[model samples]
Target: MSDLTDLLTVPVLDRSLQGALKAALNGKAKPPGALGRVEELALRLGLIQGRLIPSAARPVLLVFAGDHGLTRSGVAAFPSGVTVAMVDTLLAGRASANAFARVVGAEVRVIDAGVAADLSGRTGLVQAKVAPGTEDASVEPAMTLAQAEIALLAGARVADEAIADGANLIALGEMGIGNSASAALLMHRLAPAPLGDCVGEGAGHSPEGMARKRAVLAQAAARSVATAPLEVLTQFGGYEIAMMAGALLAAARAGVPVLVDGFIGTAAALLAVRLAPNARDYCLFAHASAEAGHRLMLEVLEARPLLQLDMRLGEGTGALLAVPLVQVACALLSEVAELADVLEAAG
Candidate 1:
């Protein structure tokens, strides 16, 4: 029953095993620094696990879907209905995230946190609805403080369930239509960056549409009374983003590294880091998204994502694609032989 502030107090990753892991990596059959970042990735895994040879199995990608009232306005190019449709696509294994998850042998779990439409009784969907959808932030606060807390807690619970189900790695993503607008606002607020820099043609908004989007977001930001991170999240962020922020903290608390997805996911990570600064240690940015705001958000987080595929898809596809890279890093630590061991075997 701990609150967000209490949850933020999760212990930092233990670094006592770093020396042993580094020694083991250096002693590997490969030449020094030959594996490059993979070796560094291996060391990070060990630090998170407090082990010299960390391992990962049952990687899971949790995609949280919601809707924004702004979609009903003219901020985005696509209709809000596309959010629910994409969720269906995700559930049917036809979406890009599904395809990537299959390739990585990772399980995909979708959550209905705040879709505008009813998605209950859907097979393979976790029902943790915070609301039908958030209120239009351009006119008012998107969600109440209590509802925001609920979304955050729901995210933490979903993450707890994933870990309990034996997932050692979790990749977080979102699917709220007009959410890039939401993410843009959150980035502007949290990164304290230029509004113009944060605005993007999410869902392929045309020049005119992008300009309209910018205007709508500007109005929303002026109305935003979100001074604190939680306030910013509650007033301007969607349920998916709030939940992912909570999920990021929970995953880090469990000492599991989160493969944070694109712009939307990075916004959540930014809020999580703002609330719990140590949470950054538990996240691996999945990619540098093509979204205009994502690079600045990633820069704010000081993250070097595993890939730069120029991906902007928000269904956790980018994160899922980076899964094998992390798994391979863990595998290398466990399977690669020490040069001394190799020499002894040769003798």
Candidate 2:
């Protein structure tokens, strides 16, 4: 896999960008700006882009789909086939992510990163297959180092193409069965917390299923720690997780704003941050997910998400929901008239 450090470089928000936004906001007809968080988001975005004017034109939603090896252990409530089914749903524009992206007017692209099943002749899909499936992490490493690298590169390439397509802002989402287990494993590796704390009831898992998921994650983590290095993400991480890391890194290097989704996406963000410390500057945590580990991951990154709707859906729904808020911020900063522009009444 490409060294995340080599693949991504973080962009710092320029002080001048903030100054421009503050000036724009203060100049608005309203008293020193009462636009609230919208104004704040715009200013932050301006700073993120180092421009007094930030454009969110051609926003692209990249939805990466894959299957996790741990699914074979029956750790999730949904069957492993759900991974392929959901990917097909996404490609058919019938999934939640698809609907959300459509509502937000963002173009959506689905990437089949490493689904275990064959999806031949799928229309409107980006065929970036890395492997047939990951190894069963409970028994051994989920994937080889080479497979992990391919997944990352696939994500990076998608981001590059999106940028070329004129997308200045990017949002990430994913579809994968048993991905929660992979996410939990990555969280444990990155944060070194208790397995139970890292685990969550994914895809409507029952309490019993949740327990089994946690046990599987614990076992996978133990095996990975004993045999794999920190870079060996394939041991316990999902292909989607690795690809999301790659896309984030690619976005960082391209100097574009990246809005991250929930727990699985957060795990990928954590990996990206670990590989490239500077990447954090370009990233915006879209929301605080309901997943227990998401908060810990956000805390580790010292990130402040824009929303906290108890959202647990993994289809970038949270990020898409935050889009209007960002747009409003820009509008207020750029369109609102300043107090100075107002005329005093003639006595």
| Index of the highest-TM-score prediction | 1
Per-prediction tally of clashes: 0, 5
lDDT of 2 by residue, 110-219 (tens): 88888888887999989888887688999998888788777888899899899988998899999888888888888887765677788888777877887788787777
lDDT score for candidate 2 against the true structure: 0.81
The 0-to-1 C-alpha lDDT of every candidate, in the order given, reads: 0.88, 0.81
lDDT of 1 at 250: 93
Q: Report the Cα lDDT for residue 123, model 2.
A: 92
Q: TM-score of predicted model 2?
A: 0.93
Using lDDT as the measure, the top candidate is 1
Lowest-scoring 10 consecutive residues by lDDT in candidate 2?
223-232
Off by over 4 Å in 1: 345-347
The list of candidate 2 runs beyond 4 A from truth reads 1-5, 11-13, 226-232, 343-347
Q: After the best TM-score superposition of candidate 2, give how far the Cα of residue 254 lies from its true spot, in angstroms.
A: 1.4
